[model samples]
Target: MRAVPTLAGGFPDISEMTVARQVHWQRWLAAAAILVVLAAIGRAFVNGQIEWTYVSRFLTAKVILEGITNTMVMAVLAMALGIVLGVVVAIMRLSSNPVLTSVAAGYTWLFRGTPLILQLLLWFNLALVFPTIGIPGLWSVRAVDVMTPFLSALLGLGINQGAYTSEVMRAGMLSVDVGQYEAAQAIGMGRLRALRRIILPQAMRVVIPPLGNEFIGMVKATSLASVIQYPELLHNAENIYYANSRVIELLIVAGSWYLLVVSILTPLQMLLERRFARGALQITR
Candidate 1:
């Protein structure tokens, strides 16, 4: 019988690596021991130390679910705005006009310069600055009165998201080949038309994966909005915890909901990644 050759990094098609049966057994044993310890802890806390009566009756499922829903809504709205504004900023930065470039640069620099929490507070209190954000002799509305904590949080998160996403988009745009741009121009497309029709199509392939990461980051960032009285997940959890005084319970509920959301988004991100990477790996040779 011939001995199989082992390759480094990964198993080769023609060679079989030696399987560490002992190592596998040891790992299983270790995992079992950890599970046993966890089971022991669960058994100890099931009826003895954990004050089950208070947790069971006080931790209302409805409130926790509402918090989860609010969190998703905030994430969706903020990311939608962020992506739209980020695309505009990326385009502006790539534009021929100096004014557009400066405006886009200033926006990215200013927002990215400040902390997200500070930005949130700034939006929450924006009404204080202008009182009415409107053009003269045109439609006007009370800023503070109309922009509640919820709207403030949405705007803050979205705009801040735009500032960061703009850089990601700009980087992705730069990654595109100069040849593609030339080809678009050669096809009798105007600069704007070429950018919209050709550049953006290819740029998105690069932008999407990192953008998914930003979406995940935004999910966690929404928790900060609770400070401004936005009824997002953490705020909702706080309300429940404050009412029943079950701080840990409410926190666990909020964390679990966050885990669920991120878990769901994980698959979606992978799908998008696969879609974008489809033709990238194709080799003409």
Candidate 2:
């Protein structure tokens, strides 16, 4: 390339000047080191005592499949329950009434303060405290029968999840501009109607990403229910390993399934975020 001489003492021929790119030798060395470490880990796993045959066999085993199905079922139901309670609690938390706010705060404190595994055990053993549970002068049933592993796990997980979810929902709601609330009030809309029509729809865009992450977390948290004898994927995997003594292999199978599920969920969550934030994207552009 030819450079034109400037009127002022000829400017360094700009077009002809070569721009040297900076070499990041340290980054290259770090990357190489990381790759070497990963390769060593992979080699160890491949040469480990674990039986890959058992992993492959049990990956699609009927019991494992059923366990995964149950896991998905419980995760969905529990998250749904949590979301419902979260919305209600968040509303109560933001209410004008002191009683409602205090109750909501207390609920959050009680659930969020306790360990989830302890909550699960408490629910499972509730029969010890309440031998019989039912409405007065109505149908009564033994607490032991009502508080099965499934129901106990559901209540424990869902209620605990609600406390966390309520915070997420409250943050989302608070993200909405005060002007938006004022505008809704300026219209003939009541508080509940305005919240349902104006506030919630706007809050959804801010909330979806966090809610997706929470749901994914809920999926993994279901594994904790295995302690209560809930037949989730990990529980069934444990049973298989217990019988066959292929602990690592069974664990690998369970881990692989969890990785696959989370991998799928990550992309879906991005799509959901895009869908909800479409208006904001358009406005920005």
Candidate 3:
């Protein structure tokens, strides 16, 4: 290719047609690859091996419905606990007190370092190490009795979620300008009051988006509870497939429900992010 003169004499001129042609080829390659993959997937779905009829029949099965309800309940309760613990730990991590900061750091380190499945198993099998449980003389119970599948799942998922949530909460809080805190303090506001009234509202704009993603992730993560024999959606689906010997169909049923839930949640998350972003946009403008 011959170099052409440019407006700037020091620089070589590039051919617009050449660049456009390259881009055109790249786009076509990508489009073709996508189409091929889609076609393969379509062929697989249409293949007689997958038993689509069974998938449809069990899509609205009673047990699957119950499983979905349980999964939602687990996600909500776990996320609620996570949010509460996250807020507390985030505040503690931000505290000036060394002890509180250390404790918060330790908690995050411990939970985030471990695999979630390990945590669930540990909680489920805690009875092996601690045979009895109680609050002194006030109450007493066996460890196994206390650590039901539901409770084990909650503790495992919720506590693990808290470690991640705390980091997110802390990042959001830190995103607020330092002067905002000083300004709040200047107006005769206590730290807690300032945080509640002046800081959190702004922080929520940053927090809501990631928190929404985490909530969506939690919905999928609930399937881990199945390892502990918790009868959430995937667990129930597994039970049905085991009984019916129609494994792939039941998987499709479970997957369909997950897609449905996520599709519903994505818009809600966007709405919340937008709602919390009101003041931020104005301030930036």
Candidate 4:
């Protein structure tokens, strides 16, 4: 019998034509199935009972535009609040003090454990529990008056976001080498200064990608504000459809606007990631 050819490394040379040729039949089957599914979906969308005209007509309507504005505003404000709280919580979590750590942990646990919609409802209806809210011996406001739909949605979403953001920030902070922290301290840098100047810049490389995802998710999560009658995109779309009975079309409009926002954000995220990554790489080198 002929000896199979061997390479310089004493391995069988598959190029010598002794290896069996295998067909990737499963891959081909999967491709075919995917094509069939796509075709079915395309046909349904083209011939379905949905009125495509309304989608186009209401896509840029004034009401929709206003809703988009509200969504953007809400997302921006909520994310800002969340980030501030997240930084505070993350620092507390990493602190040597047990009280600070425990408080941070408990805050994260309570918020992250609850459903977001329930939180919105609770904030909106807080007047039922506390009729007035303010610092003692200071000016007070009625809870119902202060906790309007907008304020309620902001607190609910922002506070809930802070819980998850704290975890992400903590992970990023922990990714930095202990040596880096020690080196910063050796240079007479205080903990807060080291974090602000040296640590956070490096940690941002790790933190930014997930934070971008959270921002995108927050855009979608704003739809939940509708339950509290916040006039965001989804809520406004509901009002439009309620009057005109163009439910699917109105929803399509909202979805399209959301896609547009995400598309815009995607490039900005990539830019921010690249900027932070360059700084990190320089430090490593």
Instruction: For each candidate in turn, give its C-alpha RMSD to the true structure in angstroms.
Output: 6.2, 2.6, 3.7, 2.8
Candidate 1 lDDT over residue span 1-285, tens digit each: 775665687655463545655457888999999999999988875755445555555445776667667878899899999998998999899888999999999999999999999999988888789899788798898897878988998999999999989898888889889999889888899988887788887888888989999999999999999989988888888887788777776676677778878999999999998798777865564
**Residues 185-272, candidate 4, lDDT per residue (tens digit)?**
9999999999999888889999999999999999999999999999999999999999999898898899999999999999999999
Residue 176 alpha-carbon offset, candidate 4, angstroms: 0.7
Candidate 1 regions exceeding 4 Å error are 1-60, 282-285
Q: Candidate 3 local accuracy as lDDT?
A: 0.94
Ranking by TM-score: 2, 4, 3, 1
- The TM-score leader among the candidates is 2
lDDT of each: 0.85, 0.94, 0.94, 0.95
lDDT of 3 at 12: 65
Candidate 2 wrong stretches, greater than 4 Å: 1-18, 282-285
* Cα error of candidate 1 at position 52, Å: 5.6
Clashes of 2: 0
Q: Candidate 3 at residue 39, lDDT? A: 96
